[model samples]
Target: MKKVNYLDKFLLKVFILFVFFGSLYANDHPYIIVLGTAQDGGSPHAACKKDCCEELWDNRFLHKKVSSIAIVNPKDKKFWIIDATPDFPEQLDFLEKKTGFSLAGIFITHAHMGHYTGLLHLGREVMGSKNVPVFVMKKMKKFIESNGPWSQLVELKNIALKELSNEQFISLSTNLYIKPILVPHRDEFSETVGYQIKSKKSLIFIPDIDKWSKWSYDIRDVVQKNDYNLLDGTFYNINELPGRDMSKIPHPFIVETMELIEKDKNKVFFIHLNHTNPALKQNSLEHKNILKKGFNITKFGQKFHL
Candidate 1:
C-alpha cells in the first residue's frame, strides 16, 4: 500500500460514518426493523418439554427472541424501540449493527414480563445507559415509578419515563411520529397498547393483544388505515396448550386472526408467536397456510421501510 496523508484519514473516517448511517437514512428517511418475533418466554419457552423445541434444544440458531422492533433515524443517529424484551441485548446489538445508531429511547407497549423486563438491563446493574426516554401511558408510568429496580432506574436517571395520552402523538422528528392507542387486554399491572408509527408510510406495531373481538377498534379499520400491521400471533390455535385453560392467555389464534381479516393479507403480518406455534418453522403446514392466506409471519431481522 502507498503512504496516505493526514486529510485522507479524516475524510475516510467521515465517509465510513456516512456509509454506515446511510443504510438507515436512505432516501432521507428511516426504516422500521424487526428484532424478535417470539412471545414472552421467547421461542424456546425455558421450561417447555414440547416437540416445538425437540429439534431446537440448546440450538441458539433455532431460537427466537421475544417480540420487539426498532425505529431508526440514521439522519439523527437515533433509535426508538417498541417493547424491551428479554432478548434486548441481542436485539440491540443487531439494530446497532444494522443502523449504526445508539438507542435514543424506548416505547413500551405494556407491563408484561416480555414487554418491559429488558428495561432492567438498562438500569444500574447492567449497561447503565443514561437518560434514555421510556415513553408510556399513565398507569405504566406509575407502575415503573412505584416498582423496585425499575424505580431505581428512574431515580438514577438511567431511563426517564415520559407519560403519553392515548392517541397522542410523540413526534420524533419532522417526518416521524408515534401514536399510541389503548387496546383491551389482561391489564394486571398496566394498560396494553398498540403503536402507529408514521413516517413515509405508516405502520402499526401491536406485538400482543387480547382477542380481536375484545378490542373496541375494528381490526379491519386498523389495517385499512396503516401501510403495515404487525399484530399478535401468540398461538396457532387453542389446542397448542394441551390441558391449560388457553382462554386465560387471551391472544388471538393465528387461524382465528386470519379468518377475521378481510383486507389485503400482505398488509397484515402476525408476530409475537409462542414457542409452541409451529408456524415458526418454514417447512411446517401452519407456515404454508399463513402464506396461502396471503398474510405474513414476521421473522427476525425483517426490515420494513417507513
Candidate 2:
C-alpha cells in the first residue's frame, strides 16, 4: 500500500509540473509564438497521397497549420497576429486559450492565399467580428477592397483595412511596431512585402521572396539587424519540386540561403517550410544539419520571449 501511494504521488507531481510550465508558455509577457510553419498549402498538400502526408491524414493531432505567428503583450492581455493564415481559427484559438489575450489586430505580408484568406472568418458568415484592424500594404488594401468576399467584409464593417508603406512603422502598443519592407515575389493580385517586427525582440519574417540576389537589400544585413529571421525556407534545394519548373516561381532555396548567410547562423530560424521539404521530416539529415550548423528551425507552437 505504501509503495503504491508513493508512485501515485510521483505521477501527480509530474502532471502538475507539466501543466505549470505549459501555462507559462504564453503567460510570459511581451513574447512571440510561432503559430504555424507550413507553407500556403500546409502539410499534406492538396491532392497528395504520399507517405509524407499519410500520418497527418490519419491523425489530426499530427496536422500542421500554415505559417503564422502571434505577438502577445500579456500585461495588457492583447495580442496581434502576423500573416493570418488559412488556419486562423485554430491559431486564434490557441492564442486566446494559451495567452488569455484578445486579438488587437493583424499584420499581413502579402496577398497570398495562406497569408490573408483567413480574413474570411472575421466576416459575417462566421465570427462577424467588428472592426478587426487589418494592416497591409497600399496594394494589398486595394486588392482586398476590389475583391468579392473580402470587399464584402469591408462593406459590412467586419474589418477595417489600414495601408502601410515601405519602411513605415505602425505602433501596435508601446514600442511594438510593424515595419514593412517590399520584397520581390509574384504580384498578379497584390504587392509583396515582409515585416520587420519590433517587440521585446526584433524579428524579420519574409515568407516568400524571389531570391536573395533579387532583393534591393542584402540578406546578411537584414539578418544582422534583426535578432530573429523567420525566413523563407520553402524548399530545401533546387530539386525539391521535380519537373515543376521552379524558376517560374522563384524563391531562395534553403540550401542556397544557408550558404548565403552562413555567418549569421545563430539568428536564422527557418520558417515557412513546404510539405515537400525533407527538413520538415523528423530527424532528417537536413533538419540535423541545420541544428548542427548553429541555426534554428522554427517549430509550430514554439514561443520566444520578445
Strongest candidate by lDDT: 1
| lDDT, candidate 2, 1-306, per-residue tens | 999999999999999999998888646447788999999999978877876786678778767789988888876789899888989999999989987779999989888889999999999889999999999988899989998989999999999888888998888777677788999999988889888878767988898999999999999998998888899988889888887999997889988888888577889988888888889876789999888888888988887777
Show the colliding residue pairs in model 2.
Answer: 200-306, 201-306
lDDT of each: 0.89, 0.87
Model 2 CA deviation exceeding 4 Å by range: 1-29
> Model 1, 1-306: lDDT tens per residue?
335576788889999999988864575587888989998998778877878986687787988889999998877888899999899999999888877788889999999999999999998789988999999999999999998978999999999899999998889988899999998899999999999999889999988888888888889888888899999998999889888898787888999988888787799998999888989888999999999989999988898888
**Candidate 1 displacement at residue 290 in angstroms:** 0.4
